[model samples]
Target: MSEAQNPNATLSVAILSGKGGVGKTNLALNLSYALFRAGHRILLMDFDVGLANVDVLLGLSPEKNLQDLFRPDVTAEEVVLAVEPGGFDFLPAASGVPEMLEMDDDMREVLFHKLNKVFGSYDYLMLDLGAGISQTILSVAAMSQLRVLVVTPEPTSLTDSYAVIKVLHTQYGITDFHIIVNQVEGPADTQATFTRLSTACNHFLGFEPILLGGVRSDPALPAAVRRQIPLLRHAPRSPAAQDIVNGAVKLHRVRQQRQQALVDAPVLGKIPIIRK
Candidate 1:
């Protein structure tokens, strides 16, 4: 995607939300599949830690997870699972894993180190981060090349999302953010929501976020989730599925633009998240 991109270049994006239950993980899972379908090697990490449920969403009971990577005999590759129907690699951390719930700073570094060897094997890596602005979320997010903020039309969702943007900007100096409006009933109202969020961001944070796309409110989405099938796999023609594909395309384009920019600007090297 870059101008004759570096062979080892792997663009990492953090998929996060301000609060839970906004379908952030669902978006992350499907969007990665869309890109993987388009022929890019994709890897998804269920970084929600204690509440990890990506494996559950796919009805997968993995033999190993992020926790297993810490085991002396378990390597990072062994902990990674090859997800079916999506054809992408997944790193799952099951729910109720107390160690994952309370990862110390050293654990974070070790986890990253264990996975860094495998990062170059993929074209993109999606970090399905936990909701809110926890230090665990922010530190890993700050290391990513881009962050896509998922939101809904609810008033509380908007407020909490703004709080996330504020903290990322003020604390970490992260100004660029892409937005995806989920659960949209129509384009007009969706645009209004994005406008409201963007206005607050531009006025207060001094930066306007980019709108990737909006996912329609579709019953089929929940139905597919309930059945433990991916939206694209269970209902490929569904409106929500199509919306996710569209958003993935837009996201791919943004990555391409950023890649080209890095080529032209020498100092814009890949942000190293796995430093020794």
Candidate 2:
């Protein structure tokens, strides 16, 4: 089945980062829960491939993952695991599986088709991509409607994040990006970090990224992770969790505005002539 044939319109977001240990996956997991709480049907895909950890974070032991898609008899629906309590579904990836890391063009297309077929029912499909820019990462990023770059206050994180943006913009022609500065000290730090990054991008890459906001460095976040649960569920009142909720709301509003602009756009065609 094709995407156009599906009645529901799904907005796909890829949560990516330039380096690991920046809390990208954690944000993705919590943001998924946040969106679900807002009454949207969400699907989270652990597209981190060989380093997949969504199942570990959720304390789930799924029998199937992306590897199962390679099997002739298995379908995409069979590989999806639903997270209890949060009620959002996720397609887990196999960790440390060397073979799963490499996919040719044919395999990639097949996987894309499978996901497209099963994702129509979802209002939002969030892909928790692995850190760094790779062939696999680029493929998924290109496929997604929104690419969110998760970064931190560290200098290395900022540099790496800029490199990823440069590659995507110069090579793939991806101009618009949504950025979330994670693990920050305060709003001042967040704004400062965003300003620096945006200024650099505008100066070098010629395109400024949209700041979706920042996630503060909350102790509750790490504690919740250690307990193998989403921050939103483990500590609903935590600052980090609240940040995710706020980010989700902002994302929805941005999407709505873009859709409205498209709807209100003028159509182009040749003017018809009238006869006397």
Candidate 3:
């Protein structure tokens, strides 16, 4: 469907990573919270069907999930869980449901159509996609307006991230990407990590991803995770939380710029007439 026909023009962002254990989900959750706190209506959907855990991290026990939406009688609005205190919405995915991981063309189209209807009410839809380059992940990433790739300081993480980027760029033709360096030591580490990845991408893929920012390593993050609370709310002053807030601000600015660019672009199929 064309962008104008879509009811929800909400900015959709897919948060993904090349490998697991890179704190991608945590970053997604905290970033959603940060955006919500900044007065934006946000919906965080745990699209990691196999190991869905956004609710687990938030200590929420959602009775319904994306699985319910698959039923013909159910609607996407009914499956969403409104998080308390902040009023942000969370869409939990079905964990350990192998069927949910793979989707046929028809199913994929129906699911996204329902999602667009439900997400139309929100200003932002943050999809926490599963790690790696699964078909589902690539599909969702291709549809999203903003694609944020999370990477760590580890060599394996960087390599895997490059692999995913290469596939998306070459196979899916998705060149625009925003890189987030997670679990960093300091500013130098963040810059080094981003530079290494961007340099490789530029040399090979011929595209350089924008560095969204970095989240520093902090003890508070683990403690918050253990407590099943978002680090932003658990320890707002922590370095990691601060980093997430900064990243959210950058994301908002990028979204605005893209919107402006679209508005400024000239429309086709219009005829100009000379004035009398």
Candidate 4:
């Protein structure tokens, strides 16, 4: 939300995780909704490619999807679905399209170009990246302005996050990253998990990741999923919903502060402002 992230430049963040089924999409949907509620124009992209589910999470059945963008005469605007009353639009990935997982560099370039054209009108572009660290997902991660890595409390989840971190460092040379601990039973559990991840990154990756905060395991999240609406809209008072709202506020505040700094200082050392 830094001044650098004004209407002239859109702040793009990719919500990702090394492991699947850790509520990556869930957090992304509500988080974007929270930002939208805060009056930011957001364009959410379902980068899950062939296994896209953001639309499903919203209980939407779009006639034209990401696949339609690849058609001979289709424009990116034609396939984007508008999530009304919230000021957020989305470009849903095509489910059951195997080719999405195997896009070449050329196709990837095309995708980014089209996305860039459509993204110009928005203030924030949030990408719900697919699970796992494949070439496609990694490429998207490397290209995005901010990367929000989600992981659970389990050891396997930690290991997978570490692996993804290793890949990002080795391949993209990216060091500025954020982590969100999801499904935490309590604060102590969240701290322990965060500490373990911090220690792993320090000892192994030679970098420190900012802890963006945690979300308690709440039944309302899944219930909202069942109802095909975001928890923020469906169960605003629930703990999970509250946590996401707070996180989005924090994110918004951070961006705003950064924006102010950029405006006042012109060039504030080397801290990179997340943008395309």
Per-prediction TM-score: 0.90, 0.90, 0.91, 0.90
lDDT of each: 0.83, 0.82, 0.85, 0.81
Candidate 4 CA-lDDT value:
0.81
| TM-score, model 2 to reference | 0.90
Q: Which lDDT tens digits does candidate 2 get at residues 1-276? A: 433223345677889999999999999999889888887778899989869999989998999989788777889989988785444888999888776676767877667667666776666788999988886786677667788999999999999999888877776777879999999988898999989989999999788999999999999988988999999989999888888999999998876766544232211111122122
Question: Residue 37 error for model 1, in Å?
Answer: 1.0
Better of 1 and 2 by lDDT: 1
| Cα RMSD, each candidate | 3.9, 7.6, 7.2, 4.6
- Among these predictions, the greatest lDDT belongs to 3
- Please give the ranking of all candidate structures by lDDT, highest first, separated by commas: 3, 1, 2, 4
**Per-residue CA lDDT of candidate 3, range 105-220, in tens?**
67776676677667766667899999998877877787777899999999999999999899888776778899999999999999999999999999998989999999999999
The whole-model C-alpha lDDT of candidate 1 against the native structure comes to 0.83
Q: Candidate 2 local accuracy as lDDT?
A: 0.82
Q: Per-residue lDDT tens digits of candidate 4, residues 171-276? A: 7788878888999987788889989998999998899898888999999998999999999999999998888988898877666655543333311022223333
Error of 3 at 214 (Å): 0.8
Give the Cα error of residue 240 in candidate 3, in Å.
0.5
Q: Kindly give the stretch of ten consecutive residues in candidate 3 with the minimal lDDT sum.
A: 266-275
- Candidate 1: regions farther than 4 A off: 1-7, 85-87, 260-276
Where in model 4 is the C-alpha error above 4 Å?
1-7, 260-276
